[model samples]
Target chain A: MTAQPRIVEVRQKVLRRNDVLAGELRDRFREAGVYVVSLVSSPGSGKTAFLEKILTMMGRQARIAALVGDLATDNDAVRLARAGVPVRQIVTGTVCHLDAVMVQSALEGWKLAELDYLFIENVGNLVCPSSYDLGENLRVVLMSVTEGEDKPLKYPTIFNGADIAVVTKIDIAAAVEFDWNAARANIQAVRPEMEIFRVSARSGEGLTEWLASVESRRAAKNRPG
Target chain B: MHELSIALSILEGAAEEVERQGGGRVYAIHLKLGSLSGVAKDALIFSYKLASEGTPFEESRLVIDEVPVVVFCPECRAERRLSSIQQFCCAVCGTPTPDVVRGRELEIAGLEMDV
Candidate 1:
């Protein structure tokens, strides 16, 4: 008699474990009243620069701390710590993105309640970072003027997943001849009704509005539910 | 690429399924690959081979079912398959669709095994 092959139905999500952990982290963040924000962008999108500026601007008032992810170096961690806020580096080694477990582990020995705002700077990749949820209340995706206007269209998944979009390097937007209308149109096309913030880390323009918006949103999230 | 990590997760998931099935050797794994899942099919197949090494799945095959992106348009009140990833607007009314009804799947559909 011939041996028969068995077919077993699995129907399981591949990243379900990460999703569960991220849910737990979200609960923990909510209970502790610590608002978490994460940043995602392609490399050289001025994410670190903008984060540095934000930390410098709101660190004292918000009691903010940060955790930055990269493929190899602690360079971002080092640079962000210079703003005098507690910063940790999650070195992903060969991984292209940061998962919930990595974030939970990197936050070892730290009290989430003690920190009002915790920022997670994901590995600088627009594609992979969108797939993993790191339990952040606000997920901000960045695009620099130098990266072209159609970036949001090219990576719609990332844009669709983000709560807010930030346009960086606006100080040189005129010098680069960045098309404001085209950029806004493209972002709107991919994600209609998306809130976008334009800022320049060098001149610090638009930082106050961004900070105020973040503060208001965080307050909204902290409302008794 | 993150495909390797995804491949690892698939293997882990498949192994658990295999164990729950009262012990069997997995011959092939079936997966649903979606357009909006942000996973490359060819890259995932290649990574699966590398990740399966030295494990029971070393000789197993990965069979992926490619799923097309499907979005629902509230204006049109219809769900349509996306012809292009760049164009998310409804095929009927041309209104942009923010509701994705399908094509974000990244899951192990089933397993072919010998009991």
Candidate 2:
């Protein structure tokens, strides 16, 4: 005789392991006094350029490091090393995104307390990265002028998950006819009141303001509740 | 694209739950997938089938309950169901609010098993 199948109650998160690990990472970052920032975007959105600019500009005053995620190559890490800070490349192989476990393992020998700022450049895919949290104080989603104004609307999930939106390659905005107002509107439509930064990493436009905003945000993170 | 990974995680979670229940053959898995969870339901279903091969859940059915995005509208002082995931505003008062109260759930609600 076959027994009847019964319904079992199991209210559990599928990503609970990742969430727990991320929570631990968040606590560790807090104790170590390092401001962690993560960048996410579709491929060729100028994330590497923007991050390289930030690292190069802030390297003099801050103890900085970066963990860059890519499918196969260390090319980005090689390029970013020009800034002269400690940089590590996380080769994800077939994986599309970086989870907390990857980030934890990547920081094996590094001392988080010695660093003032740590940047994680996620794999250049908007969809998968939105599902995982890397314990970062800020998650910046970048969209280049060449990607069109409707990028946010098309990938609303990633934009909605991010804390800030950055418009990259503004120096060539006119060549691409990128509608700033339309892009901002689309982003606001999805995220509502999200802080945005317009930047040109090549020409150094808006770098000062962006840097100031980041510093202030980091300072605010250090404030005790 | 990462649905395969998500499918594997679901299998892992279900297996643990089954083990905790003294071992059972799961026939169905109930999942709550949110609009903002960044996972597509159809892709996940397909991936689940591929991931479940040779496992106890090989023949299991994944029943997904898609949860719509809901945000807290401060202007109306109420939780409102968003009409569209693209626009995060109160359906009633049209107040724009970033305070999302629900709709990011990717959880296993229940499992049907033969113990």
Candidate 3:
């Protein structure tokens, strides 16, 4: 004779642990007066280049640091360090995404209060990174001109997860005949009213507006509630 | 790729639940996965099997209920089911709204076990 299995209600979020950690991180950032931003996108979308540009430009006006994640190499950290801002590399080994635990551990020794802005560059992956929240004030998703306008349509989950969409490598938009309007339309189709920024890290096009917008956002985040 | 991690999380949640109930042999784990949760159902099921191997849940079954994305339609003044994630508009009114009311759920709803 075998006993029948009984159903037991256990309504719980699977990622509750991550969510709790992220909530703690958010409170920590708020107390430290640091505006945290995270970047996510597919590989070869110019995340490092754009981050490098932001760090170099923003370094002059405010205190900023970055934590870059990759599957194997610290190459991105080395590249970003040239911008003169504190950069840390999180080698995920075979992991494809950065979770809240990784961010919490990486910030173990850093003084969050000393920095005005903290950027987390997630591993170059659109799919996996969308699931984990890194406790960022803003999440930016990059899509290069070479990656096609349909990129957002193909990966709506990531686009929906992100707060803003950045079109990188606009300098070669003409060379690739990338339809800017179509890209914008596609992004809007997936995530309505999503703020979009067109920038070229190589040519420095559209950097001024983007930087100003980011600075204002940071200011707003630091404003007393 | 991240499905393996998600499977592990499910296992951890189930184990905690079993312990809370004074320990039991888990027969099945019920999960509610939303379309916009960014976790593929098939991949998670496959990963669950591998993650359960050699564990107490080795013979346990994973039951997933896939939930579709739903958005609040301002024009319709009601919640509407979205036909496709690619389009955020209401299925009936076609009003574009960013107010997502549902989906994005990765949760353990229940468990069947014998204590």
The DockQ figures for the candidates are 0.73, 0.89, 0.87
lDDT tens digits, residue span A1-225, model 2: 999999998889999999999999999999999999999999999999998999999999999999999999999999999999999999999999999999999999999999999999999998999999899999999999999999888998999999999999999999989999999999999999999989999999988898899999998978889
| Cα lDDT tens digits for candidate 3, A165-225 | 8999999999999999999999999999999999999999988888888888988876779
Each model's lDDT comes to 0.91, 0.94, 0.94
Q: Write the per-residue lDDT of candidate 1 for residues A1-225, one digit (tens) a residue.
A: 857888788899999999999999999998888999999999999999999999999977888889999999999999999999999999998888999999999999999899899999999998898779899999999999999999998898888788899999999999889998999888877776778999999999988999899999998977778
Model 1 chain A poorest 10 in a row by lDDT: A185-194
Candidate 3 on B1-59: residue-level lDDT in tens? 89999999999999999999999898999999999999999999999999999999999
> If ranked by DockQ, best first, what sequence of candidates would result?
2, 3, 1
Q: Higher lDDT: candidate 1 or 3?
A: 3
Model 1 residue A62 lDDT score: 81
For model 3, the superposed segments whose C-alpha errors exceed 4 Å read none
**DockQ of candidate 3 against the true complex:** 0.87
Pairs in clash, predicted candidate 1: none
Task: Please give the distance, in angstroms, between residue A18's alpha carbon in candidate 1 and its true position after superposition.
Answer: 1.0
Question: What are the runs in model 2 whose C-alpha is more than 4 Å off?
Answer: none
Tens digit per residue, CA lDDT, model 2, B5-70: 999999999999999999978889999999999999999999999999988899999999999888
| Tens digit per residue, CA lDDT, model 1, B52-104 | 99999999999999998788988878898877777777877888876788888
Q: Give the TM-score of candidate 2.
A: 0.98
